[model samples]
Target: MFKKLLSSIGIGSATVDTKLTKAQYVQGETVEGVVDIRGGNVEQHIDEIYLALVTTYIREIDDKKFEEKAVLARYKVSDSLTIGPNETKTIPFQFALPYDVPVTVGTSRVWLQTGLDIKMALDPQDRDYLAIEPHPLVEAFLEAVRQLGFRLRHVQCEQAPRYWQRRLPFVQEFEFKPVSGPFKGRLDELEAIFFVSEHGVEVILEIDRKARGFAGLLSEALDMDETLVRFTYGPSDVASLPQRLANAIGRHS
Candidate 1:
């Protein structure tokens, strides 16, 4: 109990605090935050202050499945800042967020956050997860999906592997509830994978079809067991994603 008690008493340790100006921000928007450093008993000189956006990436390596949390983006916030014993220093920074960012659950499902990485001399990297909000355009696109009768399933983020020549390490796939009613027996599941760039969002709809037992057996024998339909949604967007997806599949089929 005494050792545990002393661990919480600062006990010759240094700490840093990071605070963001806002919890919500849009893509291409500048994010403002402050890094406050508190020194302990002795003086210390920091080599550099850095911030990075970390994301998880899933891929298959050597026929084995694995997931990696990669540093998507990084920026140097400060070069050198010294602090005396028991001294405090505050440094403010502004950074532009990537146009394509993963949407995680937050306040009213509106806030977004990315992990921050800070490296100090002779200490473990000081990391922080800062929350942010979606941009208007991103929110609008999500609303369109909801309007199309698809419920949110889950969001999975992964980095595109070498096999994926897409030049993107991080990919966010948003799974949706299956289109029900008449379509319930037709399709297995639906997913909307968004690849956002500076210009707009690249929406890809993946439809998994449920096959009959006989047909399934035949396809499996032929080494083709599943059917996946892929399509792209563009800037001139449609209000209903399900309807649009149906049309796209129809035209392609």
Candidate 2:
């Protein structure tokens, strides 16, 4: 089940419209958009008008799986007010995306949604969709990985859950393949998790080691040990990727 809450007074409901200014953005970039609301046929006393920034996540609990739960970024776009019949209002919003905003490759399933709740007699809902594109720097980084002979296996968007942090509602994980040379023989699989924030991006990498008893998926290895590494990146530039990845590998070694 998805998470939601709504409360509307006894009058009429209001309609909501949301528009995003750009289809493409970077990890550390800002998103510009607007929310427009129109009154319905009857006058309504609205307790509050607000917009929420939400991302979908996949979660497993007690061996059960769920998808596309809403995450709240902010509230309070407007206070309590009464809108007369057939009235229209507009609100502008600027959202600062975290530096670790996950990169989407191909036609992945992800959404940036604006949800509005109108307090008429009870709360009614309105929603709008926006197109999200990879930032230039993020695309460059992926290109670099491709240059390094890595293939993207799968990519997904998920929420952090209550265990990690109060504010970190969403996270993205990318699985990749290293099919040649030294890495193929020693590593079974590589997974990258991105944690984006205001200041910079935190990259958590987990490489599954080839199990000794059984030859691992990517390569065959005997007496091997698994290793984990963390890397930090910012500015969303192409030039920084090689150096940063190299530095992280070196530190792990």
Candidate 3:
């Protein structure tokens, strides 16, 4: 009776730890791992074991900005089980990582959260940081941008407009500045948002043209100097990204 009372209050309860097959993964790949549960001083009934892929994003409301955690994807590993005292059980699981998960760049982060649900006792939880890399085609596109002499300046995940938000609540934005290319003197900066999936990559470019004389300055004041361009490319189009991207920017610059 005493043990049961203590367990209910979480003094001596089952614990859960998750082990991933690898520490780094590219977006859209399957993540395989095992949930290891060790029983405590008394038997306990676990209602469910689950895993969540989580990341943080900046959200603004009424001119106030705050950071919030977002769950990208979740999966249930087991339904129900009884763990005996001092017994250990390992449950293996595999789930596809969402392509929209933020890559680990700048202040952006991705982590896997594991939890075990109990009826009365506190839930056992574990967290593991995941290094998420850009997809291959996305990587190639970024390299192409660099080859065009745009230096990556900053990266962040923030709230997206309703029209831009799809499966995820926020979008990751990458900012670049022209350093030594044809656009160096013609443009001010470039901001890019990438939406990646199994089919292809959709890129949104906000080209900020440098303000010039009276008319250009007036347009800047009205926030009209920026042009929004969106395009989609797939694996087959990787080789032509440099020329295509140059044309896309040159048209607006």
State which candidate has the highest lDDT.
3
Q: What are the runs in model 3 whose C-alpha is more than 4 Å off?
A: none
Cα lDDT tens digits for candidate 3, 110-203: 9999999999888889999999999897899889989999998999999999999998889999999999988998899999999998999999
- List the candidates ranked by lDDT, beginning with the highest: 3, 2, 1
Overall lDDT per candidate, in order of appearance = 0.58, 0.59, 0.93
Off by over 4 Å in 1: 1-14, 62-64, 105-121, 131-138, 159-167, 179-182, 220-242, 250-253
TM-scores of all predicted structures: 0.74, 0.72, 0.98
lDDT of 1 by residue, 79-110 (tens): 77666768987888888877665565421122
Worst 10 residues of 3 by lDDT: 7-16
Worst 10 residues of 1 by lDDT: 107-116
Worst 10 residues of 2 by lDDT: 1-10
lDDT tens digits, residue span 116-228, model 2: 54532555555654345555545555665665556788888665656544355666777777776445644566777765555555667766665544444234343345466
Where does candidate 1 clash, by residue pair? Answer: 24-133, 25-133, 57-158, 57-159, 112-132, 159-169
Better of 1 and 2 by TM-score: 1
Which candidate order results from sorting by TM-score in descending order? 3, 1, 2
lDDT of 3: 0.93
- At residue 217, give the lDDT of candidate 1: 60
